[model samples]
Target: MGGVNTVNGMTGIIMLVLWALAFGATAFALIHALRQRSDAFTAVDKLTKPIWSGILAVALLLLLLSFGGLGLLAFISIIATGIYLADVRPKVDEVQRGPRW
Candidate 1:
């Protein structure tokens, strides 16, 4: 029982870390999207808006799931992240030259 409890505690800690990371990523994406919404980054605004929305949705879902709720939210987030990484981001990068690249 003690071992089981220890494992559970570790799992909870891992989940909390994942939750924090997801929250941070979503927040960053949202902020970047908003900042890019202005005239300066209008070229990529189309891409960033959807990406930001997706991230926010995913983060919210993950948050809800971390509390014993259904993991549908996390699943949605995974799909969104995959789409953003595989499709949206590449196209956006092709059109613009950001400092990070």
Candidate 2:
């Protein structure tokens, strides 16, 4: 429990939950980013597909770093995911398909 040293049972559980969430979010961002057409990002004036892909990859790596006592960085990854999901996603979706309900 060197890098991953946490308090005890309850705290460890909470950290596990947080790490799961971070991984999930990063995975979502990476998947969606990969599925989009490259032109969609240009049309939407967002990060190019490769750039977003790299960002999501780093997010995944950062989440993994929780084992190295860098769990706090998970929040930064979440923020990146939030921006991709909340801002870029809708624009890319709209470019590729019509607005939906």
Candidate 3:
């Protein structure tokens, strides 16, 4: 019984860590997205800056909805943030470079 309790406690801790990491990653993307120029998004052929901001906002909302702690809502947050970082961030960087050599 003690061993079972320990395992359950460890699982909760792991979930907490995962949630924190996911939230941190989403916040990072949101800030970086905000600091970028609106025109840069167009040049990169990604969604407009306002739209991406909305997406990030929704991701944040999902995170909040996960107040019960990492669940389906939390996974949605991670997926939303992951999309922005993986698909959009690189494009934004390229556009900001203004025709790099």
Candidate 4:
């Protein structure tokens, strides 16, 4: 029999999936930030490459420690990662690639 502390069934599966996704997202953001050119961030008027990388690194660490729980710090990390991926990434890429026109 499963103990009180044990997670089982559908809920457990969902938690596992969520944890994986959160961890993946943070890790991906960190890696992407690290790979980008240092000047790209300044060109796009975003934070410096080192700052972004640091933020993502911290976020990844928080996500790993959170274990899928949406605690305040973990939630903030998720938001930070999301911002870097959704907003900053495209601008940085565009700067690196130059204008299409």
Segments in model 4 whose C-alpha atoms lie over 4 Å from true places: 1-8
Candidate 2, position 83, lDDT? 91
lDDT of 1 at 4: 98
Clashing pairs in 4: none
In candidate 3, what are the lDDT values of residues 1-101, reduced to their tens digit?
A: 99999999999988888888888898899998999999999987889999999889889889877854788888888898999999999989987876766
* Model 4 Cα lDDT, one tens digit per residue, 15-70: 76877887898898888889999999998899999999999988888877877566
Worst 10 residues of 1 by lDDT: 33-42
What are the candidates' C-alpha RMSDs?
Answer: 4.6, 4.6, 1.3, 2.9
Candidate 2, 1-101: lDDT as tens digits = 85456457667787677678768878988999999999999998887999999998898788777652335687888888889989999899998996678
Q: How much RMSD separates candidate 2 from the native structure?
A: 4.6
* Clash pairs for candidate 1: none
Worst 10 residues of 3 by lDDT: 60-69
**Which parts of model 3 are misplaced by more than 4 Å?**
none
Question: How would you encode candidate 1's per-residue C-alpha lDDT over 8-76 as one tens digit per residue?
Answer: 998888877776665555555545444443333346555446555656565655756655332667556
| Model 3 score (lDDT) | 0.88
Could you say which candidate leads in lDDT? Answer: 3
The 10 consecutive residues of candidate 2 with the worst lDDT sum are 63-72
Better of 1 and 2 by lDDT: 2
lDDT of 4: 0.86
The regions of model 2 sitting more than 4 angstroms off are 1-7, 68-70, 99-101
